[model samples]
Target: MKILNLFFIGLLVSISSLASAQSDAEIEKMIVELHKPTKKISDSIGKLMQETKSKIETEIDSVVKENLKLRSDTLFNAFDDNAINELKQDFVFAKKYPNSLAALKLLRRHVNRFIGMNFYDTYVEVFQNFSPEIRNSEKGKEMAQNLQYFKQSKVGSTAPSFSLVDSNGKTISIDDFKGKQYVLIDFWASWCGPCREELPYIKELYKKYHQQGFEIISVAKDDKQDLWKKAIEKEQIESWRHIFTSEDNKNIIKNYNVNGIPHKVLIDKNGIIIGKWKGSGENNKHDLQQLLKSIFEAE
Candidate 1:
């Protein structure tokens, strides 16, 4: 009787292993299919950017340059829409299928982008609906915790507090601006091209809004204080609050979950976060413009 029971147990284990192998293979196939369009789109955009740059330099007519800029902007907008829709569909598939290893893998790959783009709530919901064993894994626990931070940083949540010395060695904290000003927390690095490119727009906005209680606090993830200072001086940045990641605030970037350069978080006069944007692209530019204009209307 003991031998017979052992034989049955071994058989069950063998079948389980076979099923697991098959499941892994199926997920691998899905991941490949998932990445195909993403890669294609990225390559297409790379080529388009190169072509646009060539045209921008060679063709000097002002009207033609403007038309070229509009076409480039539309292409980017369309690409973003398509990519976001595909990602949304992937999450829906995960929810519908539930416990899909492929879905979790895909989510893991794009989790930071989702967080950056403010899809934290949806990601948390779908991830939590996964199997209990998976939801309780180390990766799952870490992601769940990050989701909490993401929630805290969302629009309407109070901005996180921190104290750091600015370029002039003046200590600055979130409390300094509470009930006092509409603050723009610009997370950027001196070496980043996109960050540098957006500086002009930031200067324009600040010039228009400073009298209306708008203030900008630039944050840097730079290692060299001298280079940072030089950039500011050369670029003619307004002598406002600027914080660099140095001895005092090396972990400031982590605290804010800063995943990329040119990230901006807007805080309302009452200290609540009004909006968050990442990258120095058209989407963030439009968002920043709209928020500033709304404040203009109120003033």
Candidate 2:
């Protein structure tokens, strides 16, 4: 793995050198060429590993031995930490054997740990460095397009004010909840899976703490009234206010830089954004609850 790290570091350096050249065509050509051999090797190893279960142990051993030799010949000669880390992450020895998926999962866990320890860049940098094609990819595009909203939602920044019609069509603004010690302006839609999954927990939290000066103002982005109504009724989400942002209202979405559904912004009574933005699931509820507890206790 260390050797593999060195190999990739060398490769990145080699590629970086070509960046000074003015030709996009040349750079594209080089990217293709450089990625080709590694792709072939990776594909072959993946295929063999997928079939390794039916093979004898001796045959597996032989394959492993051959791969190590190939790796030594191609990768071990390099000496770059970042490159080596990338290569090791991309290729693990256990990937050649049966039950490789488990091994690969473990390898991924370790790789994530390593990256978390060393690369503490914010999510913006992480997304920016991703391949350009990623933005065109389905989920990638959604995230990329919404990056502005997420980035603007900083702790000290002013929470964007909006006047959205509630279920009964009355317009309301952030000022309505002004006196509350904490307010969670959750942006969601009726059709979102993660939002639906989070409803029960959110309801529980809301009910448990609403009297303590915590208010949850839910704004749905659903275009259809019936489905939105059905979800609210079914989920029994009795928050402080349940408002729906009109589908045609591009300004609100653009103002918050909301690119994804189920987005949330927690604002303190003083109107400072405090909690992390949540786009999906119940993952952040526990943290939010803890924060609320602390706030209430402090007050």
Q: Pick the candidate with the highest TM-score.
A: 1
RMSD of each: 3.0, 17.0
Estimate candidate 2's alpha-carbon lDDT, on a 0 to 1 scale: 0.60
Deviation in Å, model 2, residue 3 alpha carbon: 60
Q: What TM-score, over all chains together, does every model reach?
A: 0.87, 0.53
Q: Using lDDT as the measure, which candidate wins?
A: 1
lDDT of 2 by residue, 130-154 (tens): 4555445565555554545544555
* Cα TM-score of candidate 2: 0.53
Global lDDT of each candidate: 0.79, 0.60
Clashing pairs for predicted structure model 1, backbone only: none
Give me candidate 1's TM-score against the actual structure.
0.87
In candidate 2, the residue pairs with backbone N, CA or C atoms under 3 Å apart (3 or more residues apart, or in different chains) clash, namely: 4-84, 5-83, 5-84, 5-85, 6-80, 6-84, 8-83, 9-83, 149-257
